[model samples]
Target: MIPSLGYAVLLIIGSFVLNLVVSKIRFNRKYKFPNVVPGWPIIGNMLDVPYPAGMWGVDMAKKYGEMFTLNIGGRRLVYLNSSRVVTELLEKRAAIYSSRPYRPMMSEIMSGGARIVLMGYTDKWRNQRKIMHSILNGKQSEKKFDDELLNFILGYTGTLGEYQFNPLKSPADVFTWLSRLPKPLQWWRPFGEKFCETHVAMFQKEYNILLDKMNKGIAKPCFAVDVLHGAAKKEFEISDVEKIYTWTSLIEAGSDTTRVAVLQMIAGAACYPGWARKARDLIDEVCGQNAERLPNLADRSRLPYISAVVKETLRWRPFLQSGVPHTLTQDDEYEGYKFPAGTEFSWNAYSIALNDKEYSDPLRFEPERFMNDDLKLPAKGHCRRICVGLNVGANNIWIAAACILYCFDIEQDPEHPIDQFNTLWEEPTKPPFKVRFTPRSQAHIDLIEREGNIALATDY
Candidate 1:
């Protein structure tokens, strides 16, 4: 009977707490934004946000205007939806905006504080920024023949076997510069090849070769090579573990990201045929009928609309579903809310991108929305370790998009109607990579040779 009394008392207390949370959530009846009340101890309605984060920002902004506080595991996270507010906190107050939030797990297993992308504002960060600035800033990024080499290596080496199995009549079937490989891994399927095996094998071989040459001091300095060399020559005084960490960070800060950007551009073209056609028409006007001479960096001004389309593609489907979670190194105040230092925060860009106030006809796939100078959107930079690879990313997208626009007539399969397309709310996680770029015409061959060949003339 005594134990029963104790259990009943505890149950009563738990019920009372649950009721209190529910009331607080619905306390202000007029306001609402997917806010969920808390459950038992230490747990809030964290799972309420939509998955793949589709309409993520728009929904939140609609429910909670300029500012809304989220209770995540007892830590309060404030989401700033207004552009002006964001500019104020993340840009104007550079002193406060620059410090990075702690990422214990990633810091432990991965880069710690070496790479520019995730590193915080610190002495080491300043050093990384200095090196990064030298490596990637301003006109210096015009590292003549450097990107051209990477483009070809990515083209020739990355997709060689696939071309062999699925032979291409295109003139691009010419370069052969790869390193060694495992005996069994190099073998291809007699029929439909397991492409990943070949991709891994060949890529591993070439990457190893590049690594070996880099280590031997015999090869021309690639991006990674040059940066790491800077680190060494500068006597970074880092551990061997950190060297491996640096290399891994460099790869993360570079590779797959650029690839994904291009892939999204392709996927968007395929899904929205009208936009692609519009871009192609613009390209034809400036670049001429012969799709053979791909647009270079020089053509950006002449073909502003094409540039608009590229920007639209990025805006439509950003790769990451959310802004990387940001942690505060120092406490700050916003409005009247006192947010302590070491707090975690993030803006749901997906939600912001689709927000009605920020964009008109937000759901419509219209590049024209960004046509006028009055309303255009480039990634507004932040002080807290802002994106370091903007030029690399932009150049890659511009060049790749220019190439695709010049040569391909991307169209959705009529058999697979619009309804059949995946109506995902959030971008899928590690989504299976699938795409199709139908070659437009024979002239595309000439263009590849004209632009690609010149760039690839002497291994970049």
Candidate 2:
């Protein structure tokens, strides 16, 4: 018995060694990808990537150049660190790179495969994208939608001081892996399940309200109305659960991302008073001192300086440091490097946006750098998978920034000095300093009061 056991142990060890050798040979034969060193066998570069997943990629790019590969467990992730590679592959070759990776946590467990954001490249995703386009693209997004969105934003920000945590944050990436475990072993299962239930209930409530209004001929031409109307006409198929997830996802996307951008803009205003002064001066130039009304979407073109500020704000600290990962549907090659099918790709937005080659003094908050028309903002991401609410979100930011800058002189609170550099990755609720928003003048206060009342009263 002892001899037989020893032989079995040797056989198992031999098999393991043979598998490792085969894996190495296959990896070497197919691709000469860089950044494969210092990784464990099988697991590969899982430990190499640091927490938050953004800063590590930036550091890796500095060492590995524009493109590099990190094998997380058995999955290969291709990191694109510059605009050149991102544009060439994600934009030019979007047809193959736009598909989402299969994430059991985000898709199957939390959202039950109904969330459009995590859905893989399929007929369902295509159909959902079409619906989103119809509602948020082009003429469908007009002044009414902008006004409604702005109102929602203002209402949320007005209570920022009262909140202990940011309610708008997307589910953390760690949950995506933890959710793969059995329910009994997944500690976050209850919290995630409750979170999903709460959001779904809220979405259902909103959908029902919109449906009632539609029946009464009082519905506005918003996303809910468009989606429900489409469903009524049988133009497409969508389950009740999907409708809830779809509308909620849109709300989360449209609101949460814009919230982060606006919050970052506020931080910028507080940290860099010179830029704030420039923006205010430009706004005053366009609207005239003590103007009759707050800045509106119509004034966007005239306030070029403020526009530059917006562009710089986005480029300096993009809300999503790592843009959503895309999966390759088939084996492909780029720049002599082979990418196997199912290889995941991610654009390191933080690295690309802050690339020294692209932006001079990339860390500095310089709005004028964008004024030369040399730097392009990657705030809305790129290619076919670009954010669906790009137009609406941009308009929202423009209006909010213009109005806020026009009314208030933002400054860092003396009680709490914000470490602008360190706060880039901080949660919204835990901003390093509380910003003081003092009205520039009584006229500014009056204008804000008048506009605020009107904005509150306006029905979308």
**TM-scores of the candidates in the order shown:** 0.68, 0.84
Worst lDDT 10-window in candidate 2: 161-170
Any idea what lDDT model 1 has? 0.55
Model 2 shows how many backbone clashes?
Answer: 0
Where model 1 places Cα greater than 4 Å from the true spot, the runs are 1-40, 49-51, 110-116, 144-218, 235-244, 373-377, 380-385, 415-436, 449-460
> How well does candidate 1 score on lDDT at residue 301?
81
**Clashing residue pairs for model 1:** 52-426, 53-426, 54-425, 56-351, 57-351, 57-352, 58-351, 101-327, 292-447, 331-341
lDDT tens digits, residue span 334-415, model 1:
6655556655555565565566677786655567776777322345321122566666666667777887877887766666
Report the lDDT of model 1 for residue 411.
66
TM-score of 2: 0.84
